[model samples]
Target: MTRPVVATIAALFKRGHVLLVRRANPPDAGRWGFPGGKVDLGESLEDAAVRELAEETGIQATAKQVFTAVDAFDHDESGVLRHHYVLVAVLCSWVSGKPLAGDDALEARWFPIEQLGSADLALSLDVEKVAKLGAQIHSNRAFELGF
Candidate 1:
């Protein structure tokens, strides 16, 4: 069995918009998603998030609160033994630099909260659900707990 470990960062900007990247590889090729990637050896989660964000979107961000954690399970087309992933999603704020697509990203852009449902998001169901919750928390909307 092969277990794929991945980490993703949800960069929320403009108070109500979230950053999304169009993937260049499979598992969701050409679909939109948050900026992130696999955690490299000898790197902290925060550092990995920042590094992945910069590598994929050309944006420097500071990792804030840990928004969510998700575990996903699936099988490949060849019926190979594939284990699930424990994805750590962190909330990030823009530090500097403009976004430019790179690495596994075909494009990068910000999408409004209201448009999330209509966007061609390619993340897992668990990720998408957590992202929506994170967005609400960042938005400071009618939700309780004060984010």
Candidate 2:
């Protein structure tokens, strides 16, 4: 079986809040995660990230830089190697338009930085780590520029 290459974009909003979406489909239905989807044909990773973010959440953003990459593989109960993804997460700041849940996302909300570690958060460890890294980058930039 051929493995899937997926690219994901995570939006880190102001006030240390990250956007989390509830998936509307299977593989991880009803679970909360960063707003993103699979990369489309002939699309660059950065473009894919921008597209997925707009599709999953009604927010437009520019993918500034890649903050993290994660390789994940999983099998089903039937021992089928069902899911695999090379998730490329990019750091993005909101550019235009207020966000609303859209496409594969059942819902969307701003999750505070502290809330990420709570048991209620269903995202993977890598997701949280990348978000923290993004936040750190933002913080550093702010400090340097005296924002």
The number of the candidate with the highest TM-score is 2
Worst 10 residues of 2 by lDDT: 5-14
Which 10 successive residues of model 1 have the least lDDT summed?
138-147
RMSD of each: 3.5, 1.9
Task: Name the best candidate (by lDDT).
Answer: 2
CA lDDT, candidate 1, residue 93: 70
Candidate 2 structure, TM-score to reference: 0.87
Question: How far off is residue 125 in model 1, in Å?
Answer: 3.3
TM-scores vs. true structure, each candidate: 0.80, 0.87
**lDDT of candidate 2 over 1-147, digit per residue (tens):** 585768666655667788888888755778777877677888877888888888888788887777778776656878787778878887777887666888988888888877887886787546677777778887786678786
Candidate 1 lDDT over 1-147, as tens digits, reads: 455676656555655777788879755577777777778888777888888889988888888777677765546889764656567887777788777899999998877767777645555455456668877666663245353
lDDT for model 2 comes to 0.76
